[model samples]
Target chain A: MKKFSAVLLVLAFSAAALFADGLSLADQGVFSAGGIVIQNDGVFDPVNGQYSTYGQLLHADHANIFYQIPENSNGHSMVLLHGYGQSRMGWMGTPDGRDGWNDYFLRKGYSTYLVDQPRRGEAGQTSVASAISTEPQELAWFTQFRMGRWPLFNMNSQFPQDEESIDQFFRQMTPDTGNIDFDVIKDAMIEVFDKSGPGILVTHSQGGFPGWTTAAASDNVEAVIAIEPGGVPFPEDKLPEPVDAGYYSVGGIPMSDEDFDALIEKPIIIIYGDYIPEDSDLPAERFWRAGLEMAYEFEDLVNSMGGDCTVIYLPDIGIRGNSHFMFQEKNNMEIADVIYSWLDDRELC
Target chain B: MKKFSAVLLVLAFSAAALFADGLSLADQGVFSAGGIVIQNDGVFDPVNGQYSTYGQLLHADHANIFYQIPENSNGHSMVLLHGYGQSRMGWMGTPDGRDGWNDYFLRKGYSTYLVDQPRRGEAGQTSVASAISTEPQELAWFTQFRMGRWPLFNMNSQFPQDEESIDQFFRQMTPDTGNIDFDVIKDAMIEVFDKSGPGILVTHSQGGFPGWTTAAASDNVEAVIAIEPGGVPFPEDKLPEPVDAGYYSVGGIPMSDEDFDALIEKPIIIIYGDYIPEDSDLPAERFWRAGLEMAYEFEDLVNSMGGDCTVIYLPDIGIRGNSHFMFQEKNNMEIADVIYSWLDDRELC
Candidate 1:
């Protein structure tokens, strides 16, 4: 009882001190940079002073960055990249109204740059227009995300099961204003790093593919922490047979040896969550299982080439009950600590 | 020099104290509510356990609110609605990296809820599809927003003239994933008020029309502070002739007498920025001038009905050099102070 009381007092003091001397919302800075502005060729109407649609500047294809630097800073920034169908809101906080990785890392002294990638979320403007589909995707995504079959959740899932939480989770799924063009994504992401300075790339799911490419393209990405990256990249010489995971094939992208070598220059960590089976009837699990297999292969390839890589299977480390979205799970802080420890070991924190 | 030094010292101490005890970003809460979920009627594939496209849930037509409540909150929330083509980012800060109305109101002991209307910004999902136009609107909007003609800005404009600031400003414009349906927006705004409880609606340009209707529909909206409202609401019996303002019309919405009566129950203030000429060849200025004229007519209607309504031409009060987006200008804090004073007079702060 006394120990519990002491812990409470310590927590209270820490909260008070954090409120007093650390970063407040008012102290943070928010802005955007990167992406090319395409100027259309149109003349202005002399009589009305209105530029024709062709003459206007199209400010499309940029990453919108919302960042905060704490007073007691570690001097390193964590550039958070969201997954497919998600935005910077995913990294900001959880659907359950709890502190997300944004707050956790800030409290731990690292600045955060939550990004809304090109043609998605706040960066919805695009050079090429795509039809924004209104097809119902909530259930399809919920099942595909490996949370559980529709109307039933994984028994041990850490996702908040309240109605409101589910509503919020569904609401967070955004449509692409433009097609998911890899080249567009890469250019915008590279610009984000160019402007934000050197930072660690923290990517989730689909963002991992571009994250790898951006890291190879930009010297600013110091390291990468991929949370269930869709797939890693393989050098042309070492292409593995694509795994036929239903709905989509689990195949690593083929890359040039030069790009592979550039990627190997940075230390990397790949994290996979629970409920993924070695072999299962479920396509979601099958998909991740194949991706996990690629992760080990990539890890081995990197280490053989005098590069460092770590692949962590959460259950192996006694951290379980996490779906694909481990960062938003109930034990999110516990998972954040694991990444912190990895960063510490690499002397990057 | 001594007075200047004293002022600096006082400012320094205030910053320190604010850092110590006031609301930090971590202290704020963010979540979304009030969207209808459409369940598709399709069967799941028994073989793969995948739901058909028709079987998933479509979560659409909602307001996305990012809110902050300070430790010294005034107990009343101020709901901020952005202008056309913009999002909640407009109220959060300036493109030049200065505090916006969100920070100012938070500091003044009022909680703020920055909203992204249905089919806009954070709330991008919708029931109906709208073509996200890629037509360069930057220059056209620049002229239409009264920020001076493109390639040439007003000499005394408060807008940040730096290239980076202009880039940032252009990047802030977002596309509507769905069509701009007022009914959809009204429903979503009502949901926001329902969830956030009673509060004042602080609206800009395009948001003002919906703001008035929403206030009438939802009893929770205590008051309204409209900045350069595109148009006011007029009773059907007293409808003004629609003004022709070139590219579009500047006409107040026709409302039922009961709706108008309901609106008059709440204290309202209308603010118009500078650069609006009473007679101008510029369509943008002409649009606003006609709207300004309607504001007085609406004010007279409200006042005659024993309701409170104040319309202020910014230049009339010596607050000049403001374009349409006064909230994001260099003197944003000064404008915020004017708003605070008004709220104080109404016993709202």
Candidate 2:
């Protein structure tokens, strides 16, 4: 069978080469977080087209990871976790058809494992079910993502503003099949890191919390690159007061000293895009400001605790016009380079 | 933006060409079944991360499709839909690591659009929720799929029976987020055809029902190639008596004459794998026999109604050792060739 696979692999690649003119990959496949079995004692009723789960195994609550290893691999994989109402697609390509962060990094010789977190996207099977809110929330997310007010763009916004682009963007927002559970998410992600071995961990939006937890819990997350993370981590003993952002508090997750120290032991970077006003009457802007405030506190705390942490406010760094999804904006490659440079500096690339 | 995209396209292709030795796709991207808008009347509260649905659009019940257009593609694409508890992954590759039907058809100069049916796989968002059953049913499915009974294999079974292969095979099984609704599925599929233009429809197992309905409802389906369809379609007025198979009835769906006629308008072919016993006390085998029996009836009914239909019993045609998922077995290419020949004869490829 192994020999058969080798022949087929060669034939497959050769056939691909024959076609020519697109991405060449050394390997690409998928894996899951694993599952459990349910032994049933039901009987088969053939007369009604009914059968028992009698000897069948039901696999559930597992995360799905789709990975691609480019030719001449770097041997270091980047595990990408997406934010709320989002999936691995967000990192695969931009709504406007531009190459996303995945391609950019792939070109730079890094393997990418794009994750569909448990209860979301391809990893939709869950132990607990949730009513998928079909409530219109695209506009809300647009504002929250800092793309701009409805049907309007922040001045010089890096997001592609064409109608098709916006439509595609909204279509990419997926609902969770189950209520979000941090522990469930972290466990699955740790398994991913375990399978992929030690590599960089990159999280965006809602994934940040679990990314941190997973990174701290597993030895496989060598470094962390967070893009507009929804929140940061704080020491449990010295938790900061929640910052009032009008509707929501901007308090980060409290963690044990051991977990905190383990997290800080590795290099960490938090990135914030443009359009997050320092102070605003607008709720979206105001909430983001509070979130940023917490990030600053996180940075100070991590560094003070002998951890390496860097916060890059895109505007302050003179790379402006980014919305919350900087890695998916028109200037996505530029933003990716910042991440690449950071990894390079640490010899972790 | 168009020019920018063009430039990126050229650069991306060239970059791919430089690497060589793997799949060279002219274009590959994702599109979704269109969704709805929820006009929410609400307010945003910044202090507690609370926001209203005002101006937000909620998209629901849309199917997700990932497509790859090979270089110098044949205009007639193949839209691949999966079976019960399975996703598009089944058609992409085998659990034992081998190229799947998609690659075979692609190499034959056909584009492939793999579908994750509404509320399943990547299309997990649904209007209604269902509890995910995480029972141990791998052995049951193994038997049901005719790969073999648990801890056993049918004589000369073509299934990859290695432990890892078995594990991966079971892991690929996914649960539906909601109850199965053929109308909803057909609706989403019709949209896929609408987007991709007229194409050949290929379906496996449970997908076969919706495949027929979608083809009936839309002119976009030029032909259909069904691999072990779960059941055939029957005329509503002349619905056949349900066949007693011990545990389940093997009666096909009843459709309006117009819909039935519309479905039969396209050339159709049904292929069943080996090991279906003419008489069996074993529920799985008995049930499959009944399913095959219906296929024969469906063939006669369609042909009698002045429509084209054919059934291929693999063993009768000198092919053997195939389980239900013949396309994912070692001889997947051979089975795909059978499909290609059918489409080619119809000039649909």
Candidate 3:
């Protein structure tokens, strides 16, 4: 008991420290990268267009809102989520210093807030860097792969000479490499919601898992737009055990038919890449068919418990490129447009 | 024109000689690898309850006609296409080597044929090895990251030095760099189809694209089970000009949409990994999104055009460690079950 309590205290301290060092929405460069003018309310620099840092975004006394108040009001707000290893910067249209989703949302007369969730994006980067510095050998696989070294067996060969070597190579790439603290993230989201009120939550990839978990945990969330969300239970009879200890658990994380029932009551839109296979060379037919089945199951489960849910499938919107990150693609605007239209039509915000 | 004709003749002669000298399917160990058993055939030795060579499965003429059995009283026929740089051995299953899709299908009373497509699998290895005795520097980049090497710049920091560098790294991963001849593949498929009649074409990753292309070009392809078919057109607006001289090309190819329409009226089932994002953290979101969107578009378009198509999304799957390649995972049986069930339900013989 004492050990558990001590661990909790350390976790709490780390959480507080993370908030203190967090990057603001602007300092995180989400808006500036999208060419948006930050309107500051004296706390952070709004004159030079620099908004709050990551810490400020997490612990701001007031809402650090960065949006365009259109002359003709659409009375709508657009929220965007980034995938794994990404921050709110993912919603900001282009990472290559071009117009991003934020500018598009603003231009469409909708309020946009590219929220930087704790333990992700700039914060996550800090954590990863710290981890790498502290555990060089632990991160050697990732580093080696990034540096173009042969970290695993050659996949380009017809028959790899060493199979066990390849298996060991991939055992590494997990998120629990002694870097991120999930408690900090949960608290940050709680704080942000307490201050900002509920709005639409649009997430991509792993971001969708947290978004779903948080939404399920809170009633404040209005709607969810999941672009390749990654957290729901798999269709297989047996589920994979949870790897991460936080909200994104693969284990039976207590999400009941009741939780899905409540979730479906809220409007949820899913957009996934259709070209990916469930298994290698195995077409995604079963998995996707299972997803649709799951959607129906979710809807039925929710409706049975007095909740209304709607699921939409956007086929072939082109999210896969060389690297597999959807936000970095050239047609992010199309994705943004589809999402924006969905939010507007639903009026969830 | 005369010089071109002479070159073509010389190439044809060389290709014939090479094909003659090349390793037979038996020499390449297909029977043992694919778990195929030929009854009443004296060409192969069945030792210790395992077929020793593909000679039993091969016709007297060394053609793949054994797979073209006109009628099976108690079984059906299934064809498997491996991913890039893989061969029939891939279908022989993974680390344990106890479960390949071919065996599963065969055990289910479906005769299975593992195809060695042009420019991929064993064919590619032989071609590439013959073409360049020493591994090409280009090939180094393909396997470097997998081999625990950083295929990019050496930046010690966790965050990319800048977004530009991240974008550059992702860009390097996109170019097409394989020596497989698509024309040769198409011809081979045509030859096989001519003898085999209509059958289900199962493809993974890069194999999906060519599978779809082949299905769209041939009338004998009854259905396509595309496992994570990569390279579908994304963001309808950004489609590239088809380079090959084919009916699907925008400018060069003789095969047009009309030809595809005539050939492909069959069902297409796409199976994809649900948790994996198609892009990495880079400035290619639009490109990736385009790919995703295009995959969806392909589904809808094909269906709208009288071809039945479906996309299946599998959960808890990633690029490595129980993801990416299908034949490697322990759940390959479940994957096979899904494909077989889909085929059975559709009544596609």
Candidate 4:
């Protein structure tokens, strides 16, 4: 016990330094010489005048960090997008200090570009008065990802059990104090695609929109792997009498089909986890289950339009018990293997 | 967008059935009737002459539910305990509707008893003025479980993106307005053993203490599977020059060597995830890393005392990317495979 306390005492003092500024990417040892560069795709709002305290409104812009090819590069250049309450680090670490997807893929020879959406992470901040929605609370993850029952978790949950892991995961989750303009994020994504060159578009959760939006707008996009794409397009249970007036968009706000062409050449697969409609009475579970059904509707529409889209429910492929964060789950490597297998099938990787 | 809206409209109405008081065990088809019952093993406080609201403190009480075996059961019985803010359901179902640990074990022929510590879950409630801490907020899960950076998340994070999942996980999480009465939980566990006969003990997170506490208090526990047991004992970086008075414990309180004997006959294994110092340099991550070190110290101590205690780091075993919640992860079955393998090795199953 004395020994333990001593270690604690020592760490207590050392912690100030360790946490002072956090460990930046300089030590990540990920990029080769002349392979790393940081740029911004957004512009300062300046609407309120350059001198206004709120004038900078960092709202209209975003920042991108590009990790260039390493010595034995595989020529696989991909853009990595984070999910809600997360930044690039979400793609870098597993909370327990394991290799995040960015490094995993980078090691595999991929030139990875991680993006920070406008007003998120390093992009800058915004105000609730000028945004689309209020900063979200710590509630959405519980149900959408299927970690456990809402309000109450299934002790058998696949989510992490370590308190520090849990605490860390949440600690880095910077709340959106202001609303995010999806269009800005989409534009930033397009900018990333333009700067990074067409490659595989890897997106998780909310990044799904920006990924799809970017891919839809760029012919350069080679393939799209939408990991549980947010706001997926699903056919209505009943077709409207007339399909002319409204636009159906995967991204929020109605988008017309005429606005974008079906992704014919791009091999797209939307992957979701195993348990949906968990055998519980929670409405959240049911809603999620129903939402997932849309992936099928989307597949049919794409296929009808002569586009390439495949919807994969991990369970059907023998991968079960996956929560939304399967990418970072214990079997992440296995899942990556599965994804890589798909890439191989499509000859993308 | 029209199609999405149409589908949304239909689902909005049909969702009623989909979410109606989710289908539980009666329809779960996993167990037989007369198979489950609840019992308490501690006393309630009569602080106000047995009539005040605080009079029913029940600070020293814990509740346990016992699931009897079915005719086709494997004839194995086990006591299942949950982590912080969790109860029986934590072991029963995935938020997305997959089988929980309870069903998984029961199907494996192990009758299970899910515990609700005093003032937690179905165990009952307590007054904040009398407890150890405040009720948790909706934000805790964001980091604690490695779902993503708290408040904000990775657009690429696999944590559920939908609002329902988030809301559901929290709704069930009853904060500890008061402190957990570990002694009560331990007593309850002992009673479970008395009523159910000698069996294995499967504990997660906060339940770790009770599992250990109970084991220390009784010889009925045949084996122990401490899943990410919190407050694990750690080996001192260097033993103090003078081994003075003090104790090392997983929980905050100090424990003494004279208090318990080495779990000589009962084989025990503590399971931890892949990342400790998750790549992100968050203090929370460091804290978790420190905690995991304790597991090694614990294993060393138990083994030194002629006890069979092993520390299984999943990553070392080729299981990677797992957060704290391995038992409920996507590869849960695979993890279970490993655990079962150990059990088989010990001839416990």
For model 4 chain A, give the 10-residue run with minimal summed lDDT.
Answer: A27-36
- Candidate 1 DockQ score? 0.27
lDDT of 2 at A300: 92
Q: What is residue B167's positional error in candidate 2, in angstroms? A: 3.1
* TM-score head-to-head 1 vs 2, winner: 1
Give the per-residue lDDT of model 4 (tens digit) for A192-276: 5655566888888788766766777776678888887765642333232222111122222234464336344578888887667
Question: Model 1, A1-349: lDDT tens per residue?
Answer: 0001111211121111113322354255456655657776666542364756546678777777777666667777789999999888887667777777888887777778888888888788887899988777677788778888768788788988866677777888888998887766776677666656788899999999898998899898899999999899999989889989867798778989999999989999999999888888887778889999999999999999999999999999999888888888789989999999999998887
Model 1 regions more than 4 Å off: A1-26, A49-51, B1-26, B46-51
By TM-score, the best candidate is 1
- Write the residue-wise lDDT of candidate 2 on A231-300 in tens digits: 8888887788988875568887899888998989999999999988778767778888988888898999
Top of the candidates by DockQ: 1
TM-score of chain A of each: 0.91, 0.90, 0.53, 0.74
Q: Estimate, for each residue in B271-340, the C-alpha lDDT of model 1 and write its tens digit.
A: 9889878888787778888888999999998999999999999999999999889999989988888888
Local lDDT at A45 for model 2: 36
Residue-wise C-alpha lDDT for candidate 3, range A1-349, written one tens digit per residue: 0001111211121100111111111110011111001111223221121222311111111111122233333555455545544334345423222345655555565546555443222221121222211111222222211211123222222111232222212211112112343333444443344323466666765566556665665566678777655545322333444443211223422455555555655777766543333332211223333444454454454456565455544344433321123343455566667777777677642
Show model 3 residue runs off by greater than 4 Å. Answer: A1-349, B1-75, B119-130, B133-178, B233-255, B282-290, B316-322
Global lDDT scores for all candidate models = 0.79, 0.76, 0.39, 0.51
